[model samples]
Target: MKSLIENPKDVKELRENGILFSRLGSDEEVVELFKEIDTYGLGSRYVFPDVKMRIEEHCNSKAKTWMAELIHTYFRSPWTAVALFAATFLLCLTFLQTFYTIRPAN
Candidate 1:
């Protein structure tokens, strides 16, 4: 099948980044990348839209309100949500630190 990208510049960039449609290992991966950044398939099934929708759903709410709403909806309460966010942030920080701190598998 032909490539899905519409822009010549982006197409060139994808090839340079080794991110072309055929280069993608699976059809699902091709379909689930960003439309603007990906430019490879029918458009992402997730990722970008979810981020945008999340942002839009909150509309003009403040950052703290947004976080609290997110926490209350998916979590239980404001406190729990804050705790969860902190835990996740710390977990990611530790994981990233460990990942980078590794001395390369020599």
Candidate 2:
């Protein structure tokens, strides 16, 4: 490209550079994206051409490994997820209903 951008003075300068920006979840869409320039949008040009990344992330291998393990365990047996959720929900509902409460006598 022809140095599409330089030290942008403001939104106006950014527009002239053909690089529009917007929030990642603003629902502005690709067409409406360039119409507005936001410094708060998530930018991942590979996945979302209209998204503008305005935040930084710091991570460690521990979290990555945990997430990977969780995903693998979840999909490996979807029934496990369903059963676990159902069991937990039923337990909460039962507790709320007090279905097993013992009556006290005077």
Candidate 3:
């Protein structure tokens, strides 16, 4: 099945990164395919799904959104969240204690 890409320039960008357009043949054929794909807004026609899938897998493997990752990790383990909160609270309390305890010499 044919896939789709959101950007046409991604073809040239991928090729510039040493990706060969094997299905489309040599540099000349690849250039022609690129133009056709660009005109039609079908970048995937020249690029392979494997590249897209690999990118997706890599992105999915990491925490793209730090908030989403925090929610997942913290919410999944409520104890850890509570511990982190407690640690933060303790640090704030310590800072306040030190500020109040250290009076300026008259």
Candidate 4:
């Protein structure tokens, strides 16, 4: 947590999300607190090792990374997602119609 916070804004975001609460005067105080905690050099034991491993695995997966990137790049907007769905539906309908036209009637 100490390593994750680089500035007061990071502390403010954590506070806003209820991940952190400080009785200190400002977000800067929280940042300073983290820095102070970092100097203590906590031991090697991690609180959530399993969760950290799972997150690392997810971040390392190539297919999932590519799919996430694709969605982030092309489907950032709702309208783009809707258009892709509409286009896929039209394509499937076109393929079905073509197949029916080519086959003999029962």
The candidate maximizing TM-score is 4
lDDT of 4 by residue, 53-75 (tens): 67568768999989988998999
Estimate the overall C-alpha local distance difference test score of candidate 3.
0.60
Candidate lDDT values, in order: 0.58, 0.49, 0.60, 0.79
Off by over 4 Å in 1: 1-74, 103-106
| Model 4 Cα RMSD, 1 decimal | 6.0
Q: How well does candidate 4 match the true structure in TM-score terms?
A: 0.58
What is the alpha-carbon lDDT of model 1 when measured against the actual structure?
0.58
Q: Encode model 3's per-residue lDDT on 1-106: one tens digit a residue.
A: 1243334445555555555355564445555554454335544453567767876676466555576677877678878889989999999999988887897446
Task: State the local distance difference test value for candidate 4.
Answer: 0.79
Which tens-of-lDDT digit does each residue in 1-106 have in candidate 1?
A: 1233434554554565566645666444544443335445545444365654554556456886788677668877577769888999999999988987885555
Residue 15 of model 4 has an lDDT of: 84
lDDT of 2 by residue, 2-88 (tens): 122223333344544455664455332433444455445445323432222321121235776688679787757888889889999
TM-score ranking, best first:
4, 3, 2, 1
The candidate maximizing lDDT is: 4
TM-scores for the candidates: 0.27, 0.33, 0.34, 0.58
